[model samples]
Target: MIKNIMQKVMALACSFIFSTGLAFASTQTAVTAQLVKSEADGTVLICQYRTMKKIHFKVLFTHQVCPLAIQVGH
Candidate 1:
C-alpha cells in the first residue's frame, strides 16, 4: 500500500539523518583551555601543584556529595 511505502521512506530518511549527525559529532575534536598563571605564584612548578591540589579537592568533594545527594534524592 502507499501508506506502508511512505512509512518505510520516512523511517529510512530518519535513520540517514541520525547516522550523519552522529558521524559529524564524533569527528569533532575536544578543545582544552589552559589557565594562565599569576605572577604571585613565582614559578610554574608551584602554580601547577596548586592547580592539581584544587582539582583534587574538587573531585573529592564531588564524590562525597554523590552519596548524600543520592540518599536525599530518593
Candidate 2:
C-alpha cells in the first residue's frame, strides 16, 4: 500500500515538473512582432523579445505585402 502511494506521488511530481518546464520553454522563445514600415522594396518588422542578450532580428517581406497588423506570440 505504501509503495503504491509513493509511486503515485512521484509520478505526479514528475508530470508537474515536465509540464512546468514545457510552459517555461515556450514562453522563453515566444516573441511579438509589429509591422514597422512598408515600402516598395519590402516590409519591416520590429520584434520584441525577452532574453539575457540583445539580438537584432529583422524581418523583411520583399515579395509579399507588409502585414497590416498582427498580435501573436509563438
Candidate 3:
C-alpha cells in the first residue's frame, strides 16, 4: 500500500543521511591527526611543482630523525 511505500522511502533517506555524516566525521578526524603529528615534529619541508600546480609539505619529528646521523661523531 501507500503506507508501506512511504515507510521504505523514509528508511532510505535516513540511512543516506547517516552514512554521509559518518564520512564527514571521519575525514575531520584524519585532518586533525595529521596536524598534530606535524606540530610534534620540528622541521617543515615545502615543495612546489609548477607544471603540475601542486604543493607538498611535511613536518619532521624528532623520532623520525635517523639515529645513525646522530651517532656519526661518536
Worst 10 residues of 2 by lDDT: 47-56
The 0-to-1 C-alpha lDDT of every candidate, in the order given, reads 0.38, 0.56, 0.42
Full-model lDDT, candidate 2: 0.56
Query: On residues 1-74, what C-alpha lDDT tens digit does candidate 1 reach at each position?
Result: 99999999999999999999766764244323233332232222212112322321112322222111111110
Give lDDT tens digits, candidate 2, residues 1-74. Answer: 99999999999999999999876775536444555444443354443333233333335555544454454445
Candidate 3: stretches off by over 4 Å = 26-74
User: Model 3: per-residue lDDT, tens digit, 1-74?
Assistant: 99999999999999999999876674223221112112333453322112122223443544553221111110
Q: Which candidate is the best by TM-score?
A: 2
Model 1 alpha-carbon drift over 4 Å, by segment:
26-74
Residue pairs with backbone overlap in model 1: none
- Among residues 3 or more apart in sequence or in different chains, the pairs in candidate 3 whose N, CA or C atoms overlap within 3 Å are 41-61
Model 3 worst lDDT window (10 residues): 65-74
Candidates sorted by TM-score, descending order? Answer: 2, 1, 3
Please identify which of the two predictions, 1 or 2, would achieve the higher lDDT against the true structure: 2
